[model samples]
Target: MEDIPQKHEVINWKLEQLLVFLQYCNYKESMKGPLFYAKILLFGEYGIIKDSKGLAIPFNSYKGALKSVKTLTGEAKKSNSSLIGLYDYLAKLDTELVDFDLKSFKSDIDNGMYFDSSIPQGYGVGSSGALVASIYDKYAINKITVLENLTRDKLLKLKEIFSIMESYFHGKSSGLDPLNSYLSLPILINSKENIEATGIPSQKEGKGAVFLLDSEQIGETEPMVSIFMNKMKNEGFRKMLSEEFSIHTDACIEDFLQGNMKSLFGNVKKLSKVVLKNFKPMIPSAFHKVWENGIQTNDYYLKLCGSGGGGYILGFTEDFEKAKNSLKDYKLELVYRF
Candidate 1:
């Protein structure tokens, strides 16, 4: 008789835990859900692969969401077909490590499912990342939500999971893109082992700004990555990466985070030069002169936005209107202001 209340208390505690678990389960559909956005690797680029620090920020100008439709048609059908392929992949993934509610996912596919997205593919922004985030959100069982009490272990675990999931698109993935899009927050990669969500200096509506220059052509990441991998074979390239590439990239990250704008531009210029001289094949020929012109004139500085083969060229300028006037021929979208 004495143990009855104790057992009742234990049962009540478990019920409470079960209620919390149920709340987390319905957190997405019932309340605020996810709308994953594109991500911009503002710094590091290829250098991150060489163990350099990287900074990534969410680009909300484009985003993707998972939705249900009455019928699949047009591009939705094509996208649905692609998702079916993903379904096959996820079904085979190890359940102990990362499991999804595949039954529901398959049913959704059968009932006309598609990822309606505005994210441009192979444009250096995270198109596949948005898809990975969406899939994880809808299907991943016992998934870690950004809202949970987050620890470094949990963060790393999430990144590991995302890497495997995103690898379906890119032959290999750092998991940074999906992580950035999942959190929709600026992420600072101190190193591969040390990464955390970080806050950047608040935007000031001033003449100085960061912007994206449209290359107007698709940049395939896999081949660009392959090129980088091939370049890794050269000792000179490795030396340049260690001494110049990583140096400029790390300095630029420090300068940007510290809001040392004057110094930031100098480091950015050095980075632009390094990328131009070393990463020539990655940059389109048409923009090479202009990329150099910016370095010469100081109107703006250009650097690779992603893997660089083609997509968006990241730019920084002391004066936006002046930069705009100088770059009138090309499409420039402002990303950040200072």
Candidate 2:
């Protein structure tokens, strides 16, 4: 990390965020302004790419943003280093559509600017997506505004731009993560060709819930994705993916959107079984038993949150308290109540 800048002059917060920043603590706004939250692919983990339905929502608990710190330290310094690499990557992208203000980006880095993130890297959550969104917000020229009346074509264009920007991190990317984080809204993906901002049923005071079971280990997306790609080559696997996997997944999406909780739970149980049986490699060895136990006991059903080699496992239950008591030994974090 030689020649790394140690000092920086912070910029004023964006006009829209300044009022809130003044009332809240330093954590509320980035030096450059608003942060992007992490996102969870509530449904459609791998099936989405295979032309299945998907739903993604912002996970406000973890967030990241571009910052100009007086003294870089620890995670901030590491993030700055990564952004410098990103700068080099963007500088070489030979495209008119994805152009950025590279000169300002370089200057900002030289002035000790770094991405300060609370979002955990390699957690199937949108950590790098948040970084990419933050960079585009600060440096992209003629960037699309979230406030615009987003048309289908415009949304696809944004996803394309984000795919190019974020491909540097993942060898290949679909860009849904960044799109979800940038919009900070639930996105309903009918398929690769159809996507739009969507409204989901609001949370209710009920015992039923959807929660995340932390794996406590980082899972690299590249390798997990590669494994999936390789598996897709088998004809039997493709059959199962379509007949069993996508069938259940599509049903879950339909039921959830229609607010059919009774049917949603049933579809989720089947989806969980399909995932556990066929996507075995993605589930961590430690969680395999408990994942199955939840299904058998009807306490809860666990499914892959994202790529799933070792990230948070998404769980659904008709009764949260019952599910919590059933698996008392492990940690669980609630994401939604129904």
Candidate 3:
């Protein structure tokens, strides 16, 4: 087993973080800086890759912020090292849409800057996306600010820029994750080219809810995505993805946005069933039984949260209490209430 940090070591680390925060305030940048929140793809996970509709929203429960310390150790030290690679990638990037203050960024990284983030890596809640957003927010020159009117053209431009920037982390990225984290708003993807800021129905004080089921394992995006791509090569898989997966995914997005609960659940059930039947590799093996149990019992419906070999599995249920009882063995985190 990995050795845990001693209590005193933890305290010293916290003190170093506090000192760095004070130094950060003394700098010309905005105080405390801006936090880049993790994002959740509420609908259209795999579907979005093929130009199907997608809806992603900021998940404030987990977020990342850029922090600096004169000296770094442990996790922060590791994060700083990773940032160096990202910096190297960005420094050589030749893009007209976006450019970074590579000198200042490198200076900070050399002086012990790291992402102090609560978001868990490989959980599909956009840990790398948050990191990418934070880097762009801090270093990008003449970057588009969220304050400005986000025209369709501008949104697509941002997505394109983010796509290239974030490709360093994931071999191929849709860029939707970083884009959603950067804007910190609900993003609706009509297709690859048509994306816009969208509004979701406000949460209501009802029993029906959306929740995250902890799979107690981290999921690697690249491998799972490779599996998806390999599967796409099969004509039958392509047909099912377009005809069945995309259709139900699109309906779920629309129904969710419009707050058509009855229609939404109905479509979600179908979507869940389709995912179970088709995307078995994407769903964690341990979860297959429960995934089916939800569908069979109507207690809750399970769907992939991101690539989903493991990590948090998205669940929807008419009764949160019943779902909780049904899923008593696993950890549940509430995301949205109906």
Candidate 4:
């Protein structure tokens, strides 16, 4: 729509190819969709669940694409089989309220069309959200033009659709993942209903680096969330979140946004401590000592890169060399500089 080829061209070419193939096969119309990389929440997790400000940025290391195939194989077959139930559920929804070319959609599924993505599932990287966004973009009828001036109401509607679509993966969805996928911009999630693209502060010249420490284990969001929900049932957990978690989380967001690096690290120290104290269950048993040592020794501060448990741990260090020396046992991926 903006005379740009990179984004629209790929989607359009794929759609045309599918349609031509359909015509040759005596099938229905063709639709196109864009794929996106997964995102990592640099900050805010359980804290955001309580309505504290959260920030997420696209992590291009992992990505997903939508393409129609005549057959599936191995894990792809199983994944497709699992998603059929979800597609069927969506088809049964009120037709007038939501539009989709169900026949072609189902046909693709029957023909073994599956999403081929590198984004690790349950790593808090928005893998399922990318799939959902791709489906809606390709098949939804009278789809909202993404190029149009997107209003608050439009954003809400999109979130609702994404929530339904992503439910197949997470059992429950905050809808932030798919929202970030569709927009391909950094999203600031203020509340479940209040989210928007926000500009991240520029990096500074310093010896420190903000990095992701891969736990080398896949983290299942559902199980991790289940664990948190159970923890929340305890009054002490709730009190801790209300008092320490929220305060530190809010301060961290404000400080980062204002480019107050010193203040941000200070708050991050508190956040790292709170996370270590309260989220012991979510942290890997093997990493417990390391997590505690980082906080107690002030060598580095570890926070949730996404949903914790496993995947990657967000880290802040005043001295990269010192932190690296201290965390030599674990693999670390640098994401930003300070």
Per-residue lDDT tens digits for candidate 1, residues 158-247, read 888899998888888999899999989899988888888898999999999999999998999999999999999999999999999999
**How far off is residue 299 in model 4, in Å?**
2.5
Task: Please report, in order, the local distance difference test score of every candidate based on alpha carbons.
Answer: 0.90, 0.89, 0.92, 0.79
CA error at residue 8 for candidate 4, angstroms: 38
Query: Over the stretch 157-227, how does candidate 2's per-residue lDDT look in tens digits?
Result: 99999999899999888899999999999999999999999999999999899998888878888888899
Give each prediction's root-mean-square deviation over alpha carbons.
11.0, 9.5, 8.7, 8.2
Off by over 4 Å in 1: 1-33
Question: Which scores higher on TM-score, 1 or 2?
Answer: 2
Error of 4 at 119 (Å): 0.9
For model 2, the superposed segments whose C-alpha errors exceed 4 Å read 1-30
Q: Clashes in model 3: which pairs? A: none
Which one wins by TM-score: 2 or 3? 2
Best by TM-score: 2
- Measured against the true structure, the TM-scores of the candidates, in listed sequence, are 0.89, 0.91, 0.91, 0.84
lDDT of 2 at 30: 46
